[model samples]
Target: MNKQDALSIVETHLTKKRFEHTVRVAETAVTLANLYQVSAKKAEIAAIFHDYCKYRSLEEMMRIIETSYLPKDLLLYHHELWHGPVASIKVEEEYGITDEEIKSAIYCHTTGKAHMGKLDLIIFVADYIEPGRSFPGLEEVREMATTDLLKTAWMISRNTINFLMEKKNRIYPDTFHAYNDLTRLLDGGNHFEQNAIGNIETSSGSM
Candidate 1:
């Protein structure tokens, strides 16, 4: 489906406020895509449909998880994470959006995964730092996003682990894997450091 069609379908699945947030995420994702030289169209599509199943009832999501052959262990964690995976299925089955990049981005946007691609990183970070969102350390994350997308992703992943621990919530294994992957990427060498600095310069000029 095209951008406007995706937007219309997703808006119907979300509340007004959530729809607004989805729009902001799409806008942010497109900007990040431009910064990183990825496909803005894919990013926009992923962001628009990222939360397609957010408001689904727990019973409904559990049913989807069971029948759709999603990891049963997912049931052990809070249902908030279910929407990302479920939405990936729903979009493909319902809307005929079969793009694997977009599906992967939607699937991992909530908790992330190991060795995420650039489009996945863009959607994940855009969801976190979208203009409509507000939380502690958000501004810092926003600045980090401009400079080092990978590092920023690592920070978000670490923060999520901490938050889950504080809430006594069960942490998803994929989240840990994501954290480890980003940590390795950030620590590998001067390549990442140089890219971070270069992105900061470019972002400052454009944004």
Candidate 2:
């Protein structure tokens, strides 16, 4: 679907406050995409649909999870995470948005996965540091986002893991995987530098 059509559909699915937040996220995603030299169009689309299923009834989400053959263990965790995976399915089936990059970005925005692409990182970080969100350390993350996307992602992942641990909540394996992958990438100086250069080159080619 076109951007305007997608925005209209998403606004209908969310409340006024949530729709406003969605707009902020899209703007933030566009900025991050520009900074990282990724596709701002794709980033905005992914961010627009990121929370499409957020207000779905628990029963409806549970039904989608089962029918869609998502991990059953997901049910055991907080229901909030269900929206990301469920929205990915809904956007494809309902809006005919079959782009893997957009789908993957929405799918893992809530709980990031291992080896995320540039678009995925942009959406993930955008969602966290979006203007509508206000949380501890948000300013720091916002600053880091402009200078170091991967480092910002790693910081967010670590913060998320620590928050879950403090609450004694069950942690998703993918979150840990994301944390570890970023940790490894950032810890290896030469490898990190090479990958950073390569990402810029790839982004330039795509642009």
Candidate 3:
């Protein structure tokens, strides 16, 4: 779908604030997609519908998870993580967006999965560092995004894991999976490199 059409459809499902965030994420995702030599159109659509199911009632989300191919383990985690997986299925079933790249980007946008593709990394990082967001170290990630998508993704995953640990919240397994894979892709880091993650981690940040 074209940008306007996609935005119009998604807007109906989101609150005013969330719709604005979605638009910014789409814009950011497109920028990263271009920078990383990925498809901007696909990035835009996936980011647009990334939170299509965000406002769904927990009961509805639970039913969708229980009945669909989405894993049952999701029920064991916080409902915040359910929207991405639910929206992945909803977008395809409701909008005929069967492309795996778009679906996967939406599916793992919340807690990124291991071995993500270019489009998946674009959406995950874009969603986190979108201008509308105000997380700690967000500016650094945004700057890194202008050049290196992979390293920026690695930073996001690391910071997310750190933030959750500080809050003493239980992180979803895929979150750790993303961090482990990105750490490997980046060939691991030295202690000082690990300390860089500490710069933005002093304050609490959303995942």
Cα RMSD (angstroms) for every candidate in the order listed: 5.9, 3.3, 8.7
Clashes of 1: 0
What are the runs in model 1 whose C-alpha is more than 4 Å off?
Answer: 189-207
lDDT of each: 0.86, 0.86, 0.86
List TM-score per model, in order: 0.89, 0.90, 0.89
Query: Which prediction has more favorable TM-score, 1 or 3?
Result: 3
Considering TM-score, where higher is better, how would the candidates rank from best to worst?
A: 2, 3, 1
Q: Determine which window of 10 residues in candidate 3 has minimal summed lDDT.
A: 198-207
Which pairs of residues collide in candidate 1? none
In angstroms, how far off is 145's CA in candidate 3? 0.7
Clashing pairs in 2: none
Model 1 agreement with the true structure over 40-80: per-residue lDDT tens digits: 78888899999999998899899999998689888998789
